[model samples]
Target: MIVFFHHLTLATTTTNPSYLTPSTARCNSTAVTSCTTTTSIIARCQSYEVSWNNHCYYLDGLGGNCTTGYSLATNAVLGCIATQFASKTYRSTISNNCCVWTADTYECYGFNNNCNTAGPFSAGPVWSGAGCLSVQQRYSAQLTFCGSN
Candidate 1:
């Protein structure tokens, strides 16, 4: 099997930007990199104890389907837009306080096999590019409300 890999970085452009996860977040004592501009309409994320007093608003989604686990994830969803994570993932876990609306179903940024930089995505939700093409791909908040489509 040919395994594809891509790296992602998120940033906020909204005036009232809220983080689904903190920029200096860490999991199992490992620092988690948070990106901005990621949001969703599924549920309003606020604050919570991710694991036994560990407070956070960390980004939760498929690292290997749209749900996270304790490690790098396995059989994860591919090409789906999300915060921080940009590769196929599943069952990965993060412990932290997330942003205002951290919906898993919503689009953020992920990798498409042979992923390359698509041009600037439109002004609205979030999208990703590998950095040198045109056209933006979009996902639905419906996904967040429900699950990966």
Candidate 2:
């Protein structure tokens, strides 16, 4: 399952009328189709939105960004993401998608077991742009972890 808090603007280059509407958008982590089609999610609002048992947290809204350090093929926390969230109120410890331990995102990852596990572990690096795709692409780190230490 995919869960995100920040609002997003879909496709920005299209002249189609649907682009003008506000809703959940779909963009290429690279191609970026249109911003008009882009919907809204979040802006300055940051919080730990937990799903399932508590694994899925919407890592957006924070002043900073997030990313996974571990890999699915092998467990390793080598990457870096924004630990500073706009909220920075909680200490979140992020794990990779595989459930391996990862660096701290200033908050804890309260995820449930499989089946109920929050999916699409986004290793945020949420960027500054006109829209979601305009910024960075949040891919599943295949990493997973609990909240902070």
Candidate 3:
């Protein structure tokens, strides 16, 4: 099932017309043509968003321009975020499409059980351009201990 959020466009670029449009229908990870088409329409992040502490944030500028106290967000960071997200929420492995976005953007991911039909879906909205490839930490781990005599 697909869900549509309130549609609003802060800005649009000729490079990508799908900006802020209904994107839940794009990037069907199960279909190669669908995913390719989606990717082609959307542009990469101009600001290059990065996943930090399970949250997505855009860098100050392009070409790895990071501010003080902030380092570049690499694939490793995104992968770590994906791994953490998967383990905490579903306690399962991540899909191959996990952390697929190569730019700063918003991302929508599905649970491991339904990554195909659903997805860690991207190729949609770019952060500074056109796409929906962002992440937020919705779960946390708590440890419980038992004492034995």
Q: Which candidate has the top score in lDDT?
A: 3
Report the C-alpha lDDT of model 3 over 34-97, residue by residue, as the tens digit.
Answer: 1122332322322223233323433111222333433333322333243323312211222233
- In terms of lDDT, the poorest run of 10 residues in model 1 is 48-57
Highest TM-score against the true fold, candidate: 3
lDDT of all predictions:
0.25, 0.27, 0.28
**Model 2: residues >4 Å from true position, as ranges?**
1-30, 37-46, 49-93, 97-123, 126-149
Q: In model 1, how large is the Cα lDDT of residue 114?
A: 18
Q: lDDT rank, highest first?
A: 3, 2, 1
**Model 3 quality (TM-score):** 0.20
lDDT by residue (1-149, candidate 2, tens digit) is: 99989988887675623312222323323423232313343333225432221122333211233334311110011111223322322224333332222232221122232211233333322322112221222234422322221
Q: What is the C-alpha RMSD of each candidate to the true structure, in Å?
A: 21.3, 18.4, 19.8
- The positional error of residue 143 in candidate 2, measured at the CA in angstroms, is 4.3
lDDT of 1 by residue, 1-149 (tens): 99988988788684622323222211121322333324333433233111111212223322221333222211112112233232322123331111112232222332333122222212212333222112222222111111221
